[model samples]
Target chain A: MAEIVGAYFTSHVPSIGGAIHRGLKQDPYWKPFFDGFPPVHEWLAKVKPDVAVVFSNDHGLNFFLDKMPTFAVGAAPEYANADEGWGLPLYKTFKGHPELSWHIIEGLVEEEFDPVTCQSMLVDHAISIPFELAYPDAEQWPIKLVPIGINTVQHPLPSAKRCLALGRSVHKALASWKGDERIVVIGTGGLSHQLDGERAGFMNAEYDRFCLDNLVSDPDALTKDSIHEIVRLAGTQGVEVLNWIAARGALGPGAREIHRNYHLPISNTAAATVLYEPA
Target chain B: MPSELEPIPGTTLFDGEAARKGYALNALCFSFNEKVNRDAFLADEAAYLARFNLTPEQHEAIAKRDVLGMIAAGGNIYYLAKLAGIFGLNVQDVGSMQTGVSVDKFKAMLLAQGRGESYEVAHKEMLNG
Candidate 1:
């Protein structure tokens, strides 16, 4: 049976991608943010999970307002990256794990979490930046990917509790996989930064710290807060913390926080990364 | 009609109704994802919007480059960011527009209270005043 190794959480801020693509990692404004990734690289080298189940919100890449799936799973053999109109360089097609994807989708539905399964989806910066940040040297990602899309663009988004439950379902499905595989579930986005309205360029370092501490030690307590409160406190884009909570749920509680890095104002985002290994 | 679910006062919730009203405008903004389209819009702003069959309100919102007006007219922030980027406008600029404050003040507000007070204090002020 496939054994779940751990989960990783990180921000996929597009500016981080721009800095890396433009080779401005050493530039003063971006150097601190870039400096935070080496520990992740070192940790990845150590555990080296064979598969990464990524939770990200699409920024009008594949799904627009036409039909936004609350939860979309990529079951394709491969997923492509695209330029999200800002001239961000595209990465090579990411290989997918269709068998595991299908199993997980089926299990999620059985577990009462209806997922919109996609055989083809163009991934945007939300996934690409983190990929580059983590595996900077690879022409292609070293591990197979299972891209899961969560709707954070449109309102009426799934609650943190629901996202957590969905993560639990993902864990249940992964546990049922009969093949030998080491896996990582990654929830990407949010350290309390807002990107629009009069309140744009918002960051709450204190709130972000509260989130990090609670996410590691007391996630359910964090889950109790409503999205309204989260939006009020964390800012609109900060709602992406729900993705982090989902990643925590996939690990099924009692995972030890192995590594974390939090940095601010990376192109108007409170960037963060956390790694959890099962205790 | 607004959603039966009571509206959050300070928000323009992008629910189904907003999506329907803003479909053409968002589709137009979504086109800006391609470099050619962003160039075309920059080259001839009027002609670019004409291609989308936008409502007069949407055209006005785009014409004035009003981020708040665009949101009120059903523009999603992610799509609007592309449009804003064309003018060298960043998220903070759009945010300042929405908050009805100068960019400097907006940044300062973020540093001070974030959105912790926006919904409760600002919205109440907007609603009452």
Candidate 2:
């Protein structure tokens, strides 16, 4: 049976790929942002894990305006790339675990989170971009993945509290799994940014820092904010932070912070990622 | 700019903006404003929702908006209208009820309001003063 070795929380901004790989960090506006991190390539090479349970929200692919699941997990042998109408890259599909995925689905449901399971699914930048950062060489990814997708685009989204609660439940599940392999759960999204309407390019670093602080030290406080208020405070994209709630939740109120960093540059937004280990 | 407007009043479960976007999207896609198609859709409704690529969120939004006696407090007009057709009614039936019209008679008046002319229809089912 697999046990969760640790959890990862990250920002899945599309621009990071440009900075880390192509040296988009050289661009005047993009340079300062990438400067904060100490060589992402070097970092990923070190903190390798066996499998990752990735959390992300879809951006108009697979699911559409007609129907969107609140939380959906894929149990396929692998998931393919998302087109997203923006000509997304066509990458190798992610491998999934139906038995484990169903077990998670049932456990989450029993814990009061209605997570849906899919046999096959495609992932968007929210998941794919981060995967690239962690697994620069796709074929040699150290971690097999349990991709948990959320509905951040459609509104009245799950409250940050509820998302956090779901994470806690997932942690309980890992303990019960009885698997032998070590697991790493990852949550991906924002640290304060919006991508719509008059408030389109909104950013609030102070709030981002506060959020990161609470995420590692005192996550219970995060449960206080409603999804609406969070969205209002952080901006539309900021709500994606709810994804991180899962990473925090997996630690079950007692985890040590492994690494943390924050930056704001070209996209005119704040981004951060935190690593945690169970107590 | 309905997207910019306030949420559909009393829509508590789903995202108001997406709900609103969904309404306009519904109108654009299905155009339930036409009587014949509306009737046809509502006529075999169960088989209908199954055909499209409606997300669970959109399906929930439609469910909340289309429940009986509830006001169409949502943005997706096309599905809402299709729902009205399922009940053998229209926006007039909805509006007339607001003005104290009976649903049964609202059905009758709508049928008599000339074939396929949805925009012009009014509720003769108004309650007796």
Steric clash pairs (candidate 1): A197-B95, A198-B95, A198-B99
* Model 1, total clashes: 3
lDDT tens per residue, model 1, A52-76: 8988899987888878899999999
Q: Report the error of model 2 at residue B127, Å.
A: 55
Residue-level lDDT of model 2, residues B16-125, one tens digit each, is 65465455435323444345554555577546656655656556655554332222333332234344444554444443433444555444433332222221232212
* C-alpha local distance difference test of each model: 0.80, 0.61
Residue-level lDDT of model 2, residues A1-279, one tens digit each, is 776667777677755654556646567655554444455445545655667778788755556565679888787887777433222344456666666677778789898787778887877667777777566666755567788887776665777777888888877877788667678888988877643332333456567777888887788787786666676667666778888886788766688886776765234246776677777
Q: Score the docking of each candidate (DockQ).
A: 0.38, 0.05
- Please list, in the order the candidates appear, how each scores on TM-score for chain B only: 0.83, 0.36
Clashes of 2: 23
